[model samples]
Target: MKIVNFVGYSGSGKTTLIEKLIPIFCAQGLRVAAIKNAHHNFDMDKPGKDSYRYRRAGASQVIVRNADRWAMFSETPQGAPHLSELIAHLDPADLIVVEGFKSEDSDALRLEVFREIGRGEPPICQSDESICAVVSDKAREAFSALPVLDISSPEKVAAWITEKLQIKGIEKC
Candidate 1:
C-alpha cells in the first residue's frame, strides 16, 4: 500500500484536511486508512467499563467490540511502537494517511499543512527533505520552492496526491 504523512503544528488543520480527503478518496473507489499519533496520554476506554477495568487490572491488551465496530487497545509502557509496526496491524488499503510522527523516517510521501494564523514556527519542509508539498491558506514565502496548495480546496489536494502517486481510474473532481 502507498503512504502519505500530513505534518503540522497544533491547530494547523491537518486533521481537518484528512477528514475531508477521506471521503473524496473513498468516493473515487480507493480504500483509505489513517493512523493518528497522539503525543499525549489518550484513553479510548472509560473508567468502570469492562475494557477499562480489564486494562486497569493489568491486561496488556483489551478489545472492545460491538456489531458496528471493534477496537483493540494495547499498552506500550516501554515506549511507542515504530511506524512500520503500527502499519503492519492495519488491513491492506490503497493508501494510508499518517498524521504526526514527524521525526520518524520512512518512504511515505509527506505533505506539510500550514495555516498562516496558526503558529510562527518555521515550516517542517525547511528542515525536512521528505516533504513533497505544502498545503496552506496563504502562500508561504519560505516555501516557494515547493508546490503550495490552497487549504480550502481538498479536491485539488486529493488530485495532486493521486497524480503524484500515479493512481489510476480517479478522474479529477
Candidate 2:
C-alpha cells in the first residue's frame, strides 16, 4: 500500500480537497481509504444513547452492535497512534490519504490557502521540506516555482497525484 498526505492549517480547505479526491480515486477502480486526524475531543455517540451511557459509566471501550454493522469506540489516554499502527483496520487497498498530521516528516503534497490578493504569509512553499507541490489560489505570484495548482480544481490535483505516484489502477496492476 502507498501513502499520501495533505497538510495545512485550520480553514485551509484540506477537507474539501480530500472530499473531491476520494471520488476520483474511486473512479479509477482502485480502493481508497482516508484517515482524518481530529485534535479536539469529539463525540460520535449521542447523549442519552446506550453507548454514551456506558461510556459515561467509565467503560474504556464500548461496542454497539446491530445486524448490519458493529462499531467499537474506545478511549485511550495516549492519543492517536502513528500512521502505521492506525491503518491496521483498513482494507488492504490501493492507497491511503491522510489529512492533518502536518508534523509528520513523510512525503506530503502541501496545500496553501491564499485568502487575499497580494496577501503574504510567505506561503507554505517558502519552507517545509516535506512539501512536494502546492495547491493554492489560482495565482502564480503567491507560489514559488514548485508547481502551483488551483485549490478549487480537485480533479487536476487528483490527476497530478496519479501522475506523480505513477499509479495505475488495481485492475491495471
- Highest-TM-score candidate: 1
Q: What tens digits encode model 1's per-residue C-alpha lDDT throughout 27-146?
A: 888889999999988998888999999999999998889999999999999999999999999999999999999999988989999876535789888999889899998887888689
* Per-residue lDDT of candidate 2, residues 87-133 (tens digit): 77777978788887776565444444444444334656567666777
Whole-model lDDT, model 1: 0.91
Give all candidates' CA lDDT scores: 0.91, 0.75
Q: What range of 10 consecutive residues in model 2 has the weakest lDDT sum?
A: 111-120
Cα lDDT, model 1, residue 162: 87
Give Cα distance to truth, residue 118, candidate 1, Å: 5.1
